[model samples]
Target: MLGADFYMPTRVFFGENALQRGKEMLLKAGHHAFIVTGKSSAKKCGALDEVTTLLQEGGIPFTVFDGVTENPPLLTCFEAGAKAAACGADFVIGIGGGSPLDAAKAIAAFAANQGMAPMDIYDDAKRLCPTLPLFAIPTTAGTGSEVNPYSVLTLEGGMKKKTFKAPDSWPRAAFVDPRYAYTLPHGATVSCALDAFAHALESYLSPKSTVFSQTAAVFAAREIWDVLSAMPGEFDVEMRTRLALAATVAGMAISVTGTGFPHPLGYSLTLLDGVPHGRACAAFAADYITYNEKSDEGRALIAAFAAAIGTKPNVMKAFLPGVAEVDFSFTEAEIAERIELVAGAGNYQNSPYVISKEEMYAIYRAHFLKK
Candidate 1:
């Protein structure tokens, strides 16, 4: 039997011209909008320009804080929040990829409680203040931070990547214009699509998964897999649109069920090895599939999930290997050290089975260490 509860708060607008709805979401959010984004993608993609034009034409005042970087640090979030507070920003608009969108959520939380210390943001009890309303415009197809309340932040030291989730942290609305992602490079397209697929896969396999979440995950996974498999030459605008929808659907599923082992296991690869978040997670997924297939119960669940996505279990597992290779190399001892890091993550409990340290280390060594 599946879990009982399902909840997703963000009002999503998907497709080619979704940016047109931004003016309406902005008006409903507040008067002054603090736009949080990366240094370049937003401008290069023309999302920032379109949003700025909408705000100006609508007579809405706004400020742009473009300091958000890849794998956004907690200190950067604190600084961005301070900027929002100092400027009296009533609502926040997050543009670009997952980093900016996740930063926007944290910035909203921190801006509401400007008195709280940077580290204090992690203390759930201290997050009592109402977060500023957020409107998201995602330029990339991965991360799906627009629709989810959880904000994955790498703290100041960059050693720990943690999630800060609050009910109020969900974006009030999301404008997912795939047109903004039309020019995304080939590497990013593959990595991001795989990330969305990973989100759906992990959420479906999570012990907390509900029927509703599984439905969303299956649909999203099918879209991602099909689109990824059918890429002919260069990625066109239509491909971007499909990937965006897959990401959004996957985001909604993860919001309800959260992710399982791969995400927690993949974090060290990203933080330590400098692997991109999507590819790092991808590197662990093949091992995750193999591990799950070891038990009859796991095999049954995998079969159902595979059926939902229109494939056999063995074939699905075979396709995962391509997405699971990374460029980093480590020795046996180094791999063991990294395994310890994953053991500390709280998300381990969400895995369908009890994952022992030995099992976790084996998975790490098998996927990460070259033979």
Candidate 2:
């Protein structure tokens, strides 16, 4: 049995009306709220209205910063942070998908510290300053950003994605109402669900996996796999709820064990090809599984995970392309450059098996290089 050292502080509220039910707890995060979100999703899903109404009822003053973009640039976070500070936001509420949720965490850091440069947020030393209290209201079923401390931001100068996490970056509470995800289009639904799948898969295969994290990973992976396997033409409330719970559980798994190579390996695709974050990470899932299968312990782990999900590894591998957009082609030069860019990421070290650059290149070539 693997030793456990789990520490998830985020109080997760799941089900149909989680936001409404958790309103009293949510209001306790702070006196003034900085609500960070994208322009449309939150409003469309009625989450923004719900949150604002709650604030009004609580007599809490709030500011809305609706500029978080996909991949959430560092500059945008800083700008939002400045606005949050100016408004005297004592706590932060992140709405929408992963981008806004991640941006909210960075904004909280910046707002609390005030005057720190954009890049300074990534510095480990800067973690000495406490971030403002954060509450997450996810509008989608993927990314599970509400439960994790990690905030992936697009750094300056190259559009590269980098992640930073501090102890206080975890949201104080997460209102994971699945009703908000019902408005998601088919493509967005697929992308987000696949991202959750990747998170669970990678966390299960990570060398850092503890018994607790592995259990969570298995549960999450199975739930997501069952939902995706059904391939619902339109996700009803039930489907959305399952995915939302799975994504949140997967987030918890990664929060403990971190992730394996697929996450970092997928980043170049997101930056260079504009692939959605989840689809990008999942594009490499098959290759990641195959690489890990080379080791005895890895093979055993994969078998266990496969058993938990009630499917064979090859079956899962073959099913990925149907649910994930994985056929994007790249040139040989581009593939080589992409490999070199992510080769140094610490994520690779977390893999169950040591991955070599040659193996990484081979995987890239097989999936993406133009023939």
- Any residue pairs clashing in model 1, and if so which? none
Alpha-carbon shift of residue 273 in model 2 (angstroms):
0.7
Residues 1-371, candidate 2, lDDT per residue (tens digit)?
A: 68789999998888878988888887777789999989899999999999999899999989999998888899898888888888888999999999999999999999988878888998868656799999998988889899999999988865577887998999999999888988899889989999999989989988889999999999999998988998888887778889999999999999988888888888888887778878888877878888889999898998999999999989877787556666767889988888887888889888778788888898898888887
Give the distance in Å from residue 151's predicted Cα in candidate 1 to where it truly belongs: 0.4
The top-ranked prediction according to lDDT is 2
RMSD of 1: 1.6
The runs of at least 3 residues in candidate 1 whose Cα sits more than 4 Å from the true structure, single-residue gaps closed, are none
Task: After superposing candidate 2 on the true structure, give the runs of residues whose Cα lies further than 4 Å from its correct spot.
Answer: none
Please give the TM-score that candidate 2 achieves against the real structure. 0.97
Cα lDDT for residue 114, candidate 1: 83
lDDT of each: 0.84, 0.88
For model 2, give the RMSD to the true fold.
1.2
